[model samples]
Target: MLYKELVELYKRLEKTTLKTLKTKFVSDFLKSVEKPELLEVIPYLILGKVFPDWDERELGIGEKLLIKAVSMATGINSEEIENSVRDTGDLGESIALALNKRKQKSFFSQPLTIERVYNTLVKIAEASGAGSQDRKLKYLANLFMDASPDEGKYLARTVLGIMRTGVAEGLLRDALADAFKVRVELVERAYMLTSDFGFVAKVAKLEGDEGLAKVKIQVGKPIKPMLAQMAANVREALVEMGGEAEFEIKYDGARVQVHKNGNKVLIYSRRLENVTKSIPEVVERVKEALKPEKVIVEGELVAVEETGRPRPFQYVLRRFRRKYNIEEMIEKIPLELNLFDILYVDGQNMIDTPFMERRKVLESVVNSNEWIKSAENLITKSPEEAEAFYHKALDLGHEGLMAKRLDSTYEPGNRGKKWLKIKPTMENLDLVVLGAEWGEGRRSGVLSSFLLGAYDPVKGDFVPVGKVGSGFTDEDLVEFTKMLKPLIKKEHGKEVELEPKVVIEVAYQEIQKSPKYESGFALRFPRYIALREDKGPEDADTVQRLAELYQFQERLKGGR
Candidate 1:
């Protein structure tokens, strides 16, 4: 597939909002995609070569390369290319302009197909030179060589670490569903079950769209959670809900989902990345806590303080830092797995069942020992009572409460109102941790500040919206380094790619527009609250909401 073909498809998908129409459009195109390489490139074209979890990165392509490429394509002087690219903050646009000036007509035209795109991606993903620098450069060069003009443009942006693909996971899911002639829910189900788009395509081919719908929850499939924020106190949450809700004390700990299959135990973070190796001690605790032959239990891993009370998220993070001496660290900062929701037991997929029934089954399967215990929860009809419970949680030094709807099915990765969060003033908006800068001065050894973002529904990607650096202690900084070190994938300019699993509450003075951050926004005086163990990436506030908040703040300022 030529780069132009992919761009044309992207252009079409970009215009449509309806999923049904999107599916039809995609299916129509898929019928013609005979090339296998095109199939492979679709993932990289849409998603990118690196998985969301990688964090470590090198500097992006230098200006020198941009100038050379621009000159080669346009017959322009290096100085001209440098000035244009630097002023625009976009190397791709510079290349595009140069190419256009050189030729009045299209120089290369080819149709995009599954085969061509897929082959290009395979090359990009597998490109590795002798050293790390060589590997990165080779990857960039292969991308330019294989991708069409448009593909090369975007591919260059990705290599430069500029992910300006406004389309988001939800929007992309809709597009995939449209392209495959399946329902959005079905496509999402297949994605959650397999986490493989290629697998999804195959299933869509064999069983058709409905086959995608029949995807069942299996032992190894980790479902995303329906997340909520805490309403002031539990009392406020009750008041807001007008008396109908269930309240559970939010634990200050590492969130974990333990899948026990007889003797084998696999633990995954909320983002569905396998973290079995990171928490060896937690694995042992789950083993002793549950006797189930096969089960998936979702819960928190809280670090107990000296007073036997669970400490903040920092303590739990410390246990992950070490590759060696893990046994001693596990003994030192031993964690308690606080089970809350259960999705499966034995061989049955219980997610389709109501919460009440699932909770009963969860209670029956696990022994409520201190190290591996069920989290406390209360069902109430009165908002007043729920609010009172909220107070009790904060008074106990716990984060507010997680109020879940009793009748709603667990819709993985969707933020339905079924699950509402109520937190203290300290816990405000959950900002996606975008990029972390090296700590300065006293905190020179670790990451101290994080560039954060909110989801932009229209763009379909997280938009840089804020930053938080004030609330964490030195202890928290050290702990975060241990936890965040491995999740790094690519580093470009001031941005990064991290597994969207970790969500943190941040308090900001205000929001403002800025050119420095790709998000075109910035936060004023932001501080940390807590690690949101209950919230998923999809649950984070949208960019639209952030814009609204900013506008509202402006209104207040004008009134004052």
Candidate 2:
């Protein structure tokens, strides 16, 4: 199909706000697609993506690189293109405007097709190492050379994946259901299993519901790992999970999905990126220990000290980042795997298997050893038993416990009440440093009085709670000064705004209502615990979270 035809669909989709109309627009487009191969990738393309999310290759095209390509195609100077981008906030429109001024087109340029555009992008992503930048630039320039001003608008967005398609996953799912006469639930389930809507669309288009039903787990492709909803404590978790729960230790390390297909093992991180080459030791451990020929298991991969206690979560992250001399790092920080859930075993689809039955399958298949074993767990209705297990996990250097419903099926990418995270909360909170003031008296040259803020995920910014100056040694003050100097955004006398990049755990006496900050809560007697290098600002405590924690504290006091 012509790329311009999809561009017209984008124009129409952008012009509507009604869901039914938008769904029909996408549904009609799907029906109009003639080739099955085009059907296979059009869904992804409509989402402004060259490949599925599970496919790890990025386009390797940045704003600067894209601007250079635009400049090359239109003979527009880089300066004017950048100014046009600043004037018009959209990257694609800026490139299109620049292309509109082209005096003439290339002699050999041809009209762009969806397949050609997609294939050229695949080549750009595949380009790497030693003149790869030049190659990627050439591929992009060649496409922009042929793209019309209208086609250039979408082409620019497609390469950078910033297209404003009205069709989201839900809309596309609905459209596929409408276009193919398949159940939405079936389409969704098939999407969850495959993680590729295009593939599911193709299957649904050709084979209908019967083919969708046959969509099952593939040993090598990483299924989205199940996530957990946060519970304040074990009591709340037990109450939420229906009084009796299959609780397991939640280690303070990386969660990995292990896929084994006889003599081969691949490990994926929580984000579903393949990390097989980073942790060969893990692959070796899985190959040696797992008895099943074809199976996929989910587990916590923790970096361990020599005494078998789990190290800090960041220790495992170091291994993940190391691209060179991995063998040395593997020995330097050995890892321990605690298998918790099994998704598939041999040829059987174990996702729909109940939680307790899946646990049994995991225990039955593994040759349990010290470093790699079934996670420590307890099945109980008693609060005392659950609390004891929670404390035991913390005592063993774990973060918390995961309370799972006994009969809950493993739902990929779903964080529902079927599974919950139980972690003990204190008056202390993890906060990001929003800004700081220069120290006075005995420490005159450092950012000592730190203005701290709690992360509000909804706002996507930090909301101030209070300022802390107490809990740091002189050495810490100097080190923090050195660290924060580079991230200063603005300065006014001794006070300076920061980029909210640094996270620290702050202890407080109580959370009190106040109008001093935007969050309307203040931490009394706030003191620093330590820099939380393992966490980012996104991982910091939330404003609503603090409000909820304060309410919980109030309820406990009222009961007393």
Candidate 3:
């Protein structure tokens, strides 16, 4: 197949913001492809990649390198390309413009094939040390020289790893289901377990539902962690959990998934990034605490003070960011592993197992130690007991309590009423950062005052909430600037438009009715709690949820 075909499909998908049209375009394109190998490769191409998320391979091309490559391909100077990029606020558009102005072409150039393009990009990513940057630039320039203006635009964007085509995972799942005539649930389950949609698409295309059913939880593969909904109070949590629930202390630490295969142990973060290198101490302790030769358990890794009390969440996060003198960092900030749920053990997939059974299995396998122990939990039918647990957790410098139904299954990536979190003060909402304003004074050059939004399922778009300029430290502002730089879409004086991708936990005092925001509601005194790296924009709180919270707040005020 021609790479131009895929480029045309991307153009079609970009023309419409309607999700159904986009999904249909993808489904139609997938259905037209006949080769099983190509079927496997198409999903990755649609996602603007040739490697899986867990592969740890990057294109390693920076903006400066991309500018140089485009300059070489089109014979345009680097300054001209840079100026165009600045004017358009997009590298892809700038590349396209430059390619259109090319005066000469190779005497013998082949039309870029999909296979050739994918292979070339893979070679670019696999390029390593010692003049690899020059080699990568050569490959990119050759591809651009052969590509048309539209193709060059996509090629540059894909190489930079910032394809803002708005094609998310949900759309891919729907497209796969429609193309293969399989159930969306099966595709989602396979994806959640494998974390590879390309594999899921190939299996479903070749063997259909039976192949999807054969996909099982593996020891090394990181499964998506189960998420929780928020509850108004302990009574509501207990009521939602069918009266009898297990209340566990919610620790304010990083969520980790530990996989033990024989003597080797690996730890994955909630975002499924391998943290086995960062938290070696936790891995060693997990191996010592769990008796199973092969097992997968989920827990929280907390940094503790010298007196064994938990440190702040921000302090614990420094361990993840540390790249040098890891042993010294570990000794300075020791970590504790608090096991809560087990998903696999000894060749058995335990995701379908009940919460009570999973908890029992986790307890039986884990030997209590000072650095590694099970979560402090209690089975309670009374809301008072749960409330007491919540307070006890807070008094211990932890988050609140998580109330989970005893009979609930461990549904990966699902945030439902089966598990609910109850915390003190106002409830927190996971919102998406839509845009941000340029800072002034001390933060003059950095992006600050984020424009927040909530998901609107009905419109399949993000509805604006309000802007927040509080709860961020100097370090946070710097980190956020680095993170949001690549996502900037357009600059409009003080505020810059962005692709809504970053999810953040925002704490607000109350919800209020407002016509100022597009969501028809605004948060009162909204403040950023933390960046929720585990979640995507798709997992953000819905506008309906905001309305419900507003109504609940009104009721509470009336009762008071």
Candidate 4:
């Protein structure tokens, strides 16, 4: 198929704010492609990439490099391109505008094909070291020289990983379902297992529902970790779980998915990014603790001090950033692997198994020690017992407790009521930081108020929920200013717009309906809880979830 076809769809997608319309545009385009191989490539291109997040492949092309490539292609100076970027606040638009000024088109330039663009981008990402920069620049310039002005805009945006097409994973899942006449849940399940939409699309198109059913958990591929909903209290949690549940201590640390195949071990973070090379101690500990030849386990890695007491959560993050003298850092800040659940074992997928059965299987395989052990848990049918365990966890410097239903199966990537978390403080929502306002008075020169947003699955965008200016220490204000500076997209007066990369956990006194925010609901007296470095913008709380919580609060008030 011609690359211009896809570019036209992107143009339509950019014009519409409704997600259903966007999905229709994508599904129609997918249906038009007759080739199976092209079907596999289209999903990646729409997502602004050739590989999945877990593949660890990057284009390594910075903004300056992109400016140089655009200049070379359009016969424009770098200064002209840079000035246009400043005026437009977008590099892709600047490139498109620069290319549109050309008087004549190349007579020898051929029509760009889908395969040509995908292959060229892959080659650019694979380029490395020495003179690879020049090679990449040449490839990008050649492609731009052949592309139309409209096509060049999306091409540059895709290469820069900022397509801003408003097409998210949820929309793509629905589109695949519509195009292939399959169930959305089936597509979602396949996506959760493989973490590759391209592969899922190919299978759904070729093999249909049966092929999606065959998708199982693999040892090497990381499955999306199952998430939990928040419970108001121990009594509510017990009642919701049918008066019986397994209560486990909630540790404040990094969530890791460990995959073991004989001597090889790989660790993935909650965002599915590989971090095996950063934690050698974790690899060794998993190898020694589990006796199975092949398995996939989920757990938390908490840093501890010399006395074996758990350290602050931030201390554990230092390990992820270490590239030199890793062994020395490992010794200085040792980590304890607290095993919670198992997903796969011995070539058999355990996600279909019941929680209690999986727990028994996990307990049998792990040889618990000081450094590697199961999470402290208690099986209780009484709310009093669950309450006691919750306090005990807090006394031990842990977060709170997680109450899981015994009959519940592991539902990958679904945040249902099967598992619920109860903390001592008010309820918290994981929100995306959209922008910030500059501080005033003693807090001048730094950002003091943070504009928060929640994910709207229907719109495939972050909707503004509220702003937060409290619950941050002076130290936090200074650190956050440094952290958010690089993400600044445009500044207007004291308000700075951000790229929506940072996720923060926020606590609120109540949820109120308001027309002032786009989400139609806002958090009353919202305050910053902590920076959730472990999560991404996609993992933030959804608008639907917030509405559900508001309804639950109303029911509580009526019952009282």
Q: TM-scores of the models, in the given order?
A: 0.65, 0.75, 0.91, 0.89
Per-residue lDDT over 392-496 for candidate 3, one digit per residue giving the tens place of the 0 to 100 score: 899999988888999999999887789887877657898999999999999998998999999887776888999899999999999999888778998889899
lDDT of each: 0.64, 0.84, 0.86, 0.87
User: lDDT, candidate 3, residue 127?
Assistant: 94
Clashes of 4: 0
Candidate 4 lDDT by residue in tens digits, 1-560: 89999999989998998888999998988888888888878998887767776766678787789888878887888899899887887777888898898544667999899999999988998998899999999999889888888888889888867676778788999999999988899999999997888888988899999999888877888999899887878899989999899999999888888999999999888888777888998899889999999999999899997776678777777787676899899889899989999999998889989999999999999999988888889999988888888999998888899999999999999889999988876557989999999999999989999999999876679999999999999999999998776457778999999878789988899899999999999899998878887677888888998987887777567734
The parts of candidate 3 lying over 4 Å away from their true place are 103-108, 129-135, 382-384, 439-445, 473-479, 551-560
Model 4 residue runs over 4 Å out of place are 101-108, 132-134, 321-325, 437-448, 458-460, 470-501, 551-559
TM-score of 3: 0.91
RMSD in Å for all candidates: 8.7, 7.0, 2.7, 3.2
lDDT assessment of candidate 3: 0.86
Q: Give candidate 2 misplaced runs (Cα > 4 Å).
A: 16-21, 230-244, 305-334, 369-371, 426-560
The best candidate by TM-score is: 3
Ranking by lDDT: 4, 3, 2, 1
Question: Which residue window of length 10 is worst by lDDT in model 1?
Answer: 50-59
Among all windows of 10 consecutive residues in model 3, the one with the lowest summed lDDT is 551-560
Ranking of predictions according to TM-score: 3, 4, 2, 1
